[model samples]
Target: MRFARHRTDQGPRLAVLDDEDALIDLDTEPDLPALLAHDGRLRSAGEVALRTRRRVTPWAGADLMAPLDPPTVRDFSTFPEHTAGVVKMLDPDAEIPAEFWEIPAFYFSNPYATVGPHDDVEIPPGCALFDFELEVAAVVGAAGRDLGVEDAADHLAGFVVLNDFSARDVQFHEMRMRLGPAKGKDTATALGAVFVTADELADRRSGPSYDLAMEVRVNGELIGQDRLDNMAWSFAALATYASRGTWIRPGDLLGSGTCQGGCLAELWGRHGRDHLPPLRPGDVVTTSVELLGGTRNRVVPGPPRHEILPWRRP
Candidate 1:
């Protein structure tokens, strides 16, 4: 089952995407066990909407807010290519630390992250290079920890496409701490357009895996493409490792890092192939995952609307 939040003339509402028709009033479905006790209509309507598909608008609606606005997003360095390219991309020609090999690593994003489809992202003026990453990320539905390998999958709620935008210049220059990969990555992150529930994909375990074609276009020109099934680690395993001790609650987001050849950083850092070109004002970057959905963000040069300049007169 695919879940989506949209806006209608009637105000913001959650709808279930049923191909052509969307099941209405599904806003409270996720909190079913609790909502049902207080609001019967919400429960009844949700059930009806899921039972059958009806003629409805194509999941498109007014602006879509972040599915988990107050979300806890953690990015994991799960892929091997990412590990190998780190030294060259950042430290280059520097001595290798003995602790080069580790299980995996991650960082957190503010939960109040809010952005939507087609929103214009203001690129920081001093930044020279801007890049995009395509990944499949999941939202945590339940809480669990020290969970056995067999009970892993149950903790997942759904999945969505995550665009981990990076600033190559800042990253290489600022991160002397050897921890960050942060200076480059902290600029912005794109999630949403839609989230497909785990049930939508079959047999998540036995994938070689399935290669759903992926593509990224800058200013409408194609730049990246490949399959997700080829990744070194699967989503289930990533979640299990991440939730080892801490409680992963509802609304926490976990990113699948950049997929194979998934972003400019991964490809260029390894092959010395000019992976990063640079992002300028008025650039429209779009990324798509096969059998799922596509999300696009535009680059605008300026400060965010909410940011007040220091010299703006007291």
Candidate 2:
């Protein structure tokens, strides 16, 4: 089932995307997190809709929000080709860390900063080089701790296309300080307006990865494309690794990271810095995944640089 969180006169409500592209009110639950928590009952409303076709709203008219605003967003680096491509552009001789292959590494993101499909993303402050990471994200279905790879798949609710908007300048600078990407990332993350339930993807499931085609286009021009199966580590591995003595809560988000050739940073490194211009105000970025759906976002320039950080001031 394709589920989404949409804006109604009352407020954000859970809804199901029907075959006609209409949104049927899933009045069964208050919100997505609550609905997912009650597993068995989650699909009750969809079944009712199929039988009764009630409370249907046109998808074009309904205001959609991020399908699920996760409690905690955990993004991982699982694509070796993406990493290698990035290194080839920035540091040719750099080797993939042995520890990277030993375990799936990830970083937490600001969940509150999520933007819905077709929304405008404000470029991060002090950033001139902006980029996007085309990937897929799994929304955790239930709370779990110390999970094993084999047990992780059962904990997923569904998948959505994820855009990890990036500020390359700020990111590279901060990473040099020995900390992970922060300010460069905390600004924005775009998630699909529609969330595809896990059961919907059963046919494409192969071990831990899905045989899905992922693509990113800028202003209607295709720029990045890759197969989801190219990942060196799987989402199951990422989930299990993340649950090592840590709680993987319902509504938690885990990203597949950038697919190979998924972002400009990798493209710039692989081709040339001038191969494609950095995202500018008025530019539109759209991405789609085979079963997960997609999102379209326009860039809106932020305010000019200011002295919020006195150390950088003259």
Candidate 3:
């Protein structure tokens, strides 16, 4: 079943999409996280909502919110093509680190920075090279620790399209210190208007991931495209690795990092820095993944940068 959280006069309400594509209100839970916290609640509630057309709202006019305010957001670089492209861009002769191939590496992102599908994203302070990453995210439905790859799949609740907005200039500068991608990435991350249940995608299963087409556009022009099946690691592998020595709980989000050519950085690497300019105020960016749906965000300006104290030598 397809689920969504949308704004209503009462507040944000959980909803399920009916066969006609209309949203049927699921009043038992306020949001997806609440529903998923209880075992089997999502399926049971979804079934009941579909059976009794309690309150139906047209999907076209509903005001959508991010499916849930995730407790944690872990983004993984599981696509070798994107990883290799970025490595080459940084150093033409540099090879992908052997560790990248052996482990499912990820970085924790600020969950507080999440925005809704149609919301406007602000360009980080002092940022000139703002970019967007097109990817898919898995939402955790169950709690588990140190899970194996096979057991991890059962803990997945659903999938959503994720946009990991970035500030390239700030990112590279921090990485030079071998420390962060912090403020450069924490500014914004947009999620779905639709959260698709894992079972719904059974037919598209290919290898370790669903054979879904993914794409991104800026100002109505297609800039990048790829398939989800291209990942070097599967969602289950990522989840299992994440659970190592930690707890994977309901509402946690795991992002399949930028798909092949899914960001302007990759295009910049392949072509030139000036080939496709960075996002500017009023520029619209739309990222879509098959079945999971998409998000359309407009760029906006942020506060001016404030200087911090300069580093002092001891």
Candidate 4:
């Protein structure tokens, strides 16, 4: 079943898509996270809501919001091609870390900074090289600890298109000290208007992920396109790795990182920075995935950076 969270007079309300492609308001359920937490309630609840047809809104007109405010976001670098492209860009002769092939690597991102699929994103303060990451995110439906790859897939609730916005300059600068991609990435992340259940993608299953077409556009011009099947690490492996010493909780989000050629930095590496400039204040970035829908975000200006005293050498 496809679900969404949309704005209403009361607040954000959960809705399920009917056969007609209209949103049937699930008046009782508050949001996707709440519905998923009820274990064994999603299908019945959605079915009942569809039957009642309490309030049906045209999908095109509904004011969509992010499916849920995730408790934690683990953005995993699951595509070796993307990693290799980026590593080559950073240092042409440098080889990818061997450990990357052995285990899935991920970074925690700010959950509170998430924005709705259609919301506007602000350029990070003092950021000159703004970019967008086209990726898919799996929302955890159940909780588990130290799960194996086989057991991990069972915990998935659904999938949503994720755009992990970045500030290349800030990211590179901080990573130079080998500590961060924090401030550069924490500014914004755009989630979905449509959340598709695991069953919806069952037929398209290829290898570990679905054979979904992923694309990114800037100002209506297609910049990157790839298949989700290109990911080296499966979502289950990522989830299992994430649960190695920690717990995976309901409402937690796991991003599949950037697809190959999904960001300007990668394109710049292949082409040139001069050929493709960084995002500007009014630039629009749209990322889409098959079945999961898409997110359209406009870039806007942010506050200027506040300078602080530098550390003094002893």
Candidate 4 per-residue lDDT, tens place, 1-314, comes to 99888998888888889887798888585656767887878778889889899888898899989988999999999887788777766776757689888888888999988999999999989899999999999999989899999899999988999999999999999998888789989899999788899999999999978899999999999999999999999999988998999898988999999999899888776566776889999999998898899999999999899887869966
lDDT (10s digit) by residue, model 3, range 1-314: 99888888888888889887788888586667878889999889989988897888899989999988999999999988898777766777767789988998998999999999999999999999999999999999999999999899999988999999999999998889888778889899999789999999999999989999999999999999999999989999989999999999999999999999899888787777878999999999998888888999999998999988869967
Tens digit per residue, CA lDDT, model 2, 1-314: 99888888888877888888888887665467777887766788777766776677898898888987788899999888788778766686766778778878888888988999889999988999999999899888888899998899889888888999999999888999889788888888999988888889889976558899999999999998999988888888888988999898888899999998899998888788999999999999999999788999999988777766556755
Estimate TM-scores for all models.
0.79, 0.95, 0.97, 0.97
Query: Which one is best on lDDT?
Result: 3
Instruction: Give Cα-based local distance difference scores for all models.
Output: 0.63, 0.86, 0.91, 0.89
**How many pairs of residues collide in each model?**
1, 1, 0, 0
Candidates sorted by lDDT, best first: 3, 4, 2, 1
Query: Where is model 1 more than 4 Å wrong at Cα?
Result: 21-23, 27-46, 50-57, 60-62, 82-87, 91-102, 181-183, 203-205, 208-210, 271-276, 304-314
**Winner on lDDT (2 vs 4):** 4
lDDT of 3 at 275: 87
Kindly report which residue pairs in candidate 1 clash with one another: 171-184
Q: Score residue 47 of candidate 3 by CA lDDT.
A: 91
Off by over 4 Å in 3: 311-313
Positional deviation of residue 262's Cα in model 3 after best superposition, in angstroms: 0.3
Q: Candidate 4 at 218: error in angstroms?
A: 0.4
Model 1, 1-314: lDDT tens per residue? 55556655665556566656443446344432123223234335556676743324454444564444434678865556555665465546634344433444567754443466566776754677777777767776666777665676677666778877777776777666666765467557776666666666665434623457777888888877767776566666667777888867666677777766666766566666465567778888898887667679988886643543677776
> Which residue pairs clash in candidate 2?
89-269
> How much RMSD separates candidate 1 from the native structure?
5.3
Q: How high a TM-score does candidate 2 get?
A: 0.95
What overall lDDT, based on C-alpha atoms, would model 3 receive against the true structure? 0.91
Candidate scoring better on TM-score of 2 and 4 = 4
